[model samples]
Target: MKSITVRQLADQFQLEVLVGEEQLQREVTKARAHRPGLEFVGYFEFFPTEHVQILGKKEINYLHALTDLERNLHIGNIVKYHPPCFIVTSDQSGLKYLKRYCEEEGIPLLRTKLRTTPFIGALDAYLLKVLAPEISIHGVCLNVSGIGVLLRGKSGIGKSETAHTLIRRGHRLVADDVVVLKKLSEQTLLGTHNEVTKEFLALRSVGLVNVVRLYGRKAFQDETRIVLDIELTKWRENELNNELELEPKFVKYMDVSIPHIEIQLQPGRDVAGLIEAAANNWYLKQQGYSAAEEFMKRLEF
Candidate 1:
């Protein structure tokens, strides 16, 4: 992750720092880590380092005199301070002592026009990539209301077909044919658009179809969490009684056991609608409701 300096942050928004201008050379942490300094900027013992900074308009005026002892604290000692970048929420009346201190210390004061939530969202996304361990996977990705549903099948039982149908049903398509999967956490997989297959899909009769023209902006997305997996299998009459999902079925992708379901496909079935139903069912399951369990309860004597 790239580190940000107080000066750089200040320059980005043209804000003046209130104090610690001499400490403008401090290094900002870009990503999350187990290291005590993961969320802080600069290492201890660095002579020209920034220890504390504020971001907001209202809070900047509240900061007062900095004691000699507070200033004498080493980089390591200051890191323990964990001062937050005070994000200004509104326009300030005028400059204060802190701003002058920032100028004297060469510490950067920054401002942002974005709302608090959006600014943090953008910042967090950038930071996650730097801080989190990530991995990629090869499969098909479907975005249903922001949830990434990955489909896995050998050769061509009908991964693309199901994805196409799902899109027609108002769901967004992340990737088809060849999905590039990435692991974002210990238990979460993020599916996203692959350059090779972005806005494209292969249909048995239609060949390659443009998902954007056919479905529009809502029908496509950059990436989403891989929350469900549907495996396509050729229909077999003899397998019904033998098949069992008493325990939840799952597939391993990057050390994560993704929740999954198997759908037997054959002629004369509305596969598209079925997949949609499966998605709804999976969503309901997340809310602690299961159709099969409810049916079983009704059948009990």
Candidate 2:
């Protein structure tokens, strides 16, 4: 919904408005074109109407030969135009005639030296993040029922060793390395791949192994709601005033909120048992029961 005017574009790229200074203040809803591969072009289609476009060096000559109607049509000016501006990529003064015509007709022109590809790529990536939908769902997300529970223990507290036991307990692997998160809506967080990553878990002794081949397709989920976020920390023997007991705490990502569970990792603890318990406890909460609150009410009685 936000837009940049021709004057703003000139300020952004340090380009001078050669002609149509009065018209140069027109707002551009989208980039007409960008240096290919840049992230700037993807936001163009988001507005209700087409606003402005980048007129590169290649198309400058063809535009000058056209008549009034032809000039308007070829320059993408059909329908009730929102008053378009141009980002001229070249510095040549040969286009002065065209500039004179534009000034007479009150069309704005902006100049920039950056190539087409790189500018567009940057524009696209930014728009994708801005326009992406985020959502939240209460579904259990795991790989092979174990392995890669993603334990984040304070240095040398035993996350890798705990994962080793979980692997030995018949839980296959998905990704022990890095997990990628996708924002699907205003309230949905979907876990997926980072494109450049492979579906493998890397342990210290063993480097990397393909999870799909070993655990079948079930271990590699395309996407799943991040219903739980378990953070592992060193054990504490003090009072358990704020210890989690199946009570849901939501985490926000890309404007969406998702339930999270933080578990403490420690020595001699049955981690596999705890993982299963966490999953089961989440199920119970989904079914409308709260063990911690229920036990507290009983104490009052």
TM-score of each: 0.65, 0.47
Q: Residue by residue across 1-301, what tens digits does model 1's lDDT show? A: 3466656555654654544556666666543212223222334453222223323432333322234343333222433344433334344434454344444444444455654445555555654543344444555788776566888777778888778878887898888766766666788777776587788888888899888988798888877888888888889887745422245788887688888877788899887776677777778878998776777788995
Number of the predicted model whose lDDT against the real structure is largest = 1
Q: Report the C-alpha displacement of residue 80, candidate 1, in angstroms.
A: 13
- Tell me model 2's lDDT, rounded to 2 decimals: 0.53
Q: How close is candidate 2 to the true structure, as a TM-score?
A: 0.47
lDDT (C-alpha, whole model) for all candidates: 0.61, 0.53
In terms of TM-score, the best-performing candidate is 1
Q: What's the distance in Å from true for residue 67, model 2?
A: 29
Off by over 4 Å in 2: 1-174, 239-250, 293-301
10 residues in a row with least lDDT, candidate 2: 35-44
